[model samples]
Target: MIMQKGKVKIAAVGLGNRTCKYLRYVEEHGESAELVAVVDPDPSKADWAREAFSLSSEHCFRSFDELAASGLQLDACIIGTPDLYHHELAVAAMRSGWHVLLEKPMGQTEEQCRDIVEVSAETGRIVTVCYILRYHPYFMKLNELSSDPRMGKILSIKHIERVGKDRTAHTFVRGPWNMKEMNTTVFFTKCCHDVDFVLWLTGGQVESVKSEKGTRIFTSADAPAGAADRCVRCAVEQGCPYSAVDLYLRRKDWIKGFVAQPGESQEDMILRMLDESRYGRCVYCCPENDVIDRQSVVMEMADGVKAEVVMECVTDEKDRYTVIECENAVITGDESSIEVTYKDSSVPQEKYDFQWTRGMEFHAGADHQVVKEFIDSIASGELQTRTPSSEALASHLICFRAEK
Candidate 1:
């Protein structure tokens, strides 16, 4: 939690990996932002935040309700809670006179999102959703080039989000987002960024939408014969790409959520956890997983721009590729670079580069930019971010409708 002028103190709710990523902004800009408090249900995470930020024990709370009861005077709060708690946490922070930087999808339902907007307006508090991809430089450039006079105007957009198989297995089929009872649809949990990118590029209201979705694989019928309930005990796991043993044991990555306890080795920690953990479940045997592995949506914007979005969870790599067809030219980008081809035969193609260097940073530095903008807005007394709740709500509405 931070702003530059007067060193605005910020609080954090839900001390997860995403929360830590945003707090990196405060860590670098100590002169501008102050980490006054942190709240999380996990005691270990609370301890980590307290030690890292030098926060007083009193400032570490287990819940937002507890923090509110303490009557702390914080200028802002960053909420990284789960889907079910976004509405309650955001509303509470705003009502308590603190601006908010909330992670998306901001709410699980349209009414919840509308309530966030209404409450922010009602309390005169600012709420910015974390739609970081739209802030990516490659996309920002694409937005500019699409409206160039030489290119004419944007007429339609076709975008695809490839949620690579590893991520699909880790986060969707066997993770927190696997079941409908626990979280929202894959569109909200995973692809709201894609939907919002469409709206931001077109700068128009979605008029109508038609969509279709289904699970292509990872169903019980798709399971290989002799598969065990848990990967550790499975006979066919050695060659399975989705094998938890290969990913968590041999690879030793994506362990942020399953860290080893004191005196525990990484292998032992992973095996012990996976023995009964959902992460170790056979992807094809997850009886409770309801998320579709693929979805396609066609949206008609009020500006007469058509946007087509496809999400594929069975891909080998996770990435977003977009094509913008203008009246005179067509533009395409895949994070690495952008290319434009003139509709006229004699015209040459134009290329712009972003260099694909974001792996070391969060979302290729968009996270830092977004956090900095939030702070700058606070410093300038504007109380607005590029992805303010009102604008983010437009994109979220499309996701909610498409889910229907």
Candidate 2:
């Protein structure tokens, strides 16, 4: 692939929210890259592209083969397809002479990841895995906070993911992410970011993990009598905030933007839509939802950096909960100040209730910062992708062990 005037000619394989984000990023920036080809089975999405952006008609292909065979001068391609197809698509694109910006989990298995890495080395092409949360602004702050020497040797990490009630019932519990077997295991698919973060924070490899998960509130059997496996239709939906009846067809502003904004290059709209949509399907319940609804991992990383990851679908609203107690560490947030309390270790059993707040304010949402950096790296190869095929496998190694 020849570099055209130092700009990479790119093709996007999947037309999902992620694909759209990269496309929009290029559209808005109008400098980092160019969209030379797009591949998606959805004609409507293809049509939207032509109308919203001046994408060439011939540049669109119904399949990857068509795109590769079209002889379009392309340097890189974004593999935004589902988790199962990532490896296959990525390998194909690499063999076709395209560098890859792969969406995360790298692949569903360690073997698959290794295969991709081997192929990349053999092909001499760049491959960046998309762990979007790593680029979010908030996460960068967390990274900075974790580096405080005054924070003392970090002992544990408290991570709580409040997968909204609506999302639990309508999508997660009922959709592609429903089962651990159909696609990638739940850990690799949903919590890969947390795993990566834990690895980054501890600066060590995860030695071992013990986890437990189950379907807490929603179940196919729990559906109204005679209810189908899917919750798109059920009599009890109106009363249950998380029921599929209520969340099934609900569309948030982000979803609207995802559908309406054809030339959109930012992930803000998709993130908002995911944030606004209350359907419980994407996270907790769907046909493909086989992963644990809630689970915790106790990680023993190298150097004895102990950490714990907790993921729960039981929250009224979508929010994050975090706390760090240490002196000399300046903690700040975009919204509110974080309160830190410390007591004298030398003190005998105290009879008094004490509270201390002197450190920096604590803000939330580091995932967004992780995502932004990913885009920047793609635009300007200044920041090499840390979560490449090789580095990515270390996180999923724990999940593979759990399957046994």
- Give me the candidate number with maximum lDDT: 1
Per-residue lDDT tens digits for candidate 1, residues 71-178, read 888889999988889888999899899999999988888999999999988998889899988777777888789878898888999999988888889989888888
Candidate 1, superposed: residue stretches over 4 Å from native: 1-5
How do all models score by TM-score?
0.96, 0.77
Native-vs-model 1 lDDT? Answer: 0.86
- Model 2 per-residue lDDT tens digits across residues 257-317: 2343556544543443344433323222343345566777777766666666666765675
Output the TM-score of candidate 1: 0.96
Q: Best by TM-score, which number?
A: 1
Clashes in model 1: which pairs? Answer: 1-10, 2-33
Count of steric clashes across candidates, in order: 2, 52
lDDT for each of the candidates?
0.86, 0.61
